[model samples]
Target: MSFMKKHLKTLTIALGCSAGAFYLGWQSPTLMGDVFEQQQVAQPTPRFYPLERFIISVPGKEYQHYVLLELALKSSSANAKHQLAEADPLVRNSLMKMFAGKQVDELNKPKNLEQLQQEAKDLLTNVLSANKFAVKIDDVLFTRLVIQ
Candidate 1:
């Protein structure tokens, strides 16, 4: 009974100190609002721009092959996507030229396709920046690729 009484006093004082610290450390609504705003400013949302299907013909050894490609691009700027849409014709023309030059055997390889996607990304970034577009594409995703 004596031990219980002595420990109870220590527990009560500890609780009081913890309660006081918590009360002092609690944030106000304005401070919380500022914290949330900082988090939002630090992280920006991603944006995607999808290009339509492209049917390109490349000459094979015995016959001409048809390649179907669909591309989606990712970036952080809406204005860049808008500019890409506005200059769709020029972008398509450039990509078509690149695609038309690929050999059917090369396109059939998975590694080559990955290289193609990377090349497309670099090419698109260069073209957009050179054309004075608002944003450059960070990635190129091939949603579909079929060769026939």
Candidate 2:
């Protein structure tokens, strides 16, 4: 009882300090809205550029197979999106040429599909760069793929 009484002030001071620290920490972020606003201004919203549906003929052992692919390119600027749109003819032709000789069996596998997506992104990025489009394709997304 005597020891508790002796340390009560110290404990009270420690608790008060912790509570004050927590309150300041919680309030600091709200006080710094300008910092957050600057961050938001620095980062641009992402954009997606979709290619029209692709239907390509793939070589098969006994019969020809058709692949239907829905693809979108992701970038950080509208300029990239506009560039892709302007070069739609070249883009479609390049992708069609890439997909033309692929085997149906290869497209059927999940691993092959992933590889195909990466390869397509690389090819498209290269083609766009070669054509003097100042945009980088960050990713290639396949929303729908069918091999039949």
Candidate 3:
């Protein structure tokens, strides 16, 4: 009974501190969640810049073939469209060269088409980087694709 009386004050203080800590911890996630939501809201939306249509003849063993492609570049930059306009010729030439090398069979499969989209994105990013352009491409989207 004497020992309990001696430690009672210390135990009460410890319990009070623990309760306070638990209360703060319980509230922390709500505060942190609000901060995260605000950050997400502050982030810029992605912008897309469409390229002119491309009609290229593909060399074949027997008959002539062609591919019609329409592409759009996705970026977070506000000036992506203007920058792409400046680099349009080079972009078209690079894509044309890439498509020119593809056979009809290579472009026919759905799997191949997805691969081609990724390839185009990487290729455009490289082209923009090589030219020292300020624009960064996030993705390449094919708005239209026709092969015949």
Candidate 4:
């Protein structure tokens, strides 16, 4: 009985101290100030830029033809833009090969345009893996994609 009484007193005192500390903390402006500071911190938006939509002419067994591709460039940071400096030919080559892999029907299907876009995004992710400034591809838009 005595032990229980002693332990109860100790526990009660500990809980009271804890509650008081928490209450004091809640009543202070420091937490709100910290939150305000956090909100004020500037964060950069993802840098997204236009990619050249080009028509690729590949000589095939049947005949020479043109394949159109629409592409967009994205980067997590602005440094990616500085690193890349300008438009790149390698990026175009990678995009062309990716477009060539798709069937003519797949490219022409308007319903699958989203799928094609996501595929292009994934392709960019893969191709830009080795770049100094990592780029996140937003989408591939084909302004004109006609193979003739």
Candidate 5:
């Protein structure tokens, strides 16, 4: 209907103008105001933290390399030590996975290494997030990913 089309056009114009105005205001630091504070509520609660990097051996390999991840874990040193003590098998299984889900090209290509690393991180995050209680790892990183 013509009426519907007109109302839609008006609504679109109003929304676009409002968005442009908000963007301009944000760019002008002098106009920083309470809106920023109100927007803060949309953010997620900050509890994820990165754990320290570790070098774990890969299957059929005789060497070890440091792996990094973009996880949100805390350095509860005592808790980590205790948990590892209690769940050594589970820990080993998780670490071994870093080597399992890999292709030689992905690990070897310097140009595509970033994409590979991101994929690894996403994979590890999905795996760890499933176990938010005991074997909880916020993310994974690969600091020294050498295939040797």
Candidate 6:
């Protein structure tokens, strides 16, 4: 009882300080809205540019197959639309070449399709970089994919 009384003031001060720190920390985000606003303003809005439909010929063991692919390029660049417009031909050509010679059985699997999406993204990035286009592709989304 005596010891508790002796340290009572110190303990109260420590507890009060801790609680005050917690409250301030909890409220910091709301208080820092200006910083967040600046960050949001610095980031560009994501844009999607859809390319023309692609009709690719896939070779099989005994027969020829066709893949109809309609995809869009996602980017966060301000001028993505204009850059993509200028690089459209090269983009289509690269993707067509990549899709060519793919086996039907290979593209039929879901896992393979996901891999293809990543591959397409990388291919587009390369094509844009090589062509000196100021575009950075974030993803390649397939709006329509048909294997016939």
- Measured by TM-score, the strongest candidate is 6
Note the residue pairs that clash in candidate 1.
none
lDDT of 2 at 101: 70
lDDT of 4 at 145: 63
**Candidate 2 residue-wise lDDT at 78:** 56
Task: Kindly report which residue stretches of model 2 are placed more than 4 angstroms away from their true locations once superposed.
Answer: 1-41
Model 1 scores worst on lDDT over the 10 consecutive residues at: 35-44
TM-score of 1: 0.71
Please, what are the lDDT tens digits per residue for candidate 2 over residues 13-85? 9999999999977887788665544454467678888888999999999999999999998888658867887
lDDT of 1 at 30: 53
Runs of candidate 3 exceeding 4 Å displacement: 1-41
Stretches of candidate 4 off by over 4 Å are: 1-27, 30-43, 57-65
Among these predictions, the greatest lDDT belongs to 6
**TM per model?**
0.71, 0.70, 0.71, 0.60, 0.36, 0.72
**lDDT (CA) for every model shown?**
0.84, 0.87, 0.87, 0.67, 0.51, 0.88
**Candidate 3, pairs of clashing residues:** none
lDDT of 4: 0.67
**Candidates sorted on TM-score, descending:** 6, 3, 1, 2, 4, 5
Q: Pick out the ten consecutive residues of candidate 5 with the lowest summed lDDT.
A: 69-78
**Which one wins by lDDT: 4 or 6?**
6
* Cα lDDT tens digits for candidate 1, 1-148: 9999999999999999999877756754455566544444455577878889999999999999999999888887757766878879878998998899889998899888779989988888888778887786778889999999
RMSD of each: 6.5, 7.6, 4.8, 6.7, 14.5, 7.2
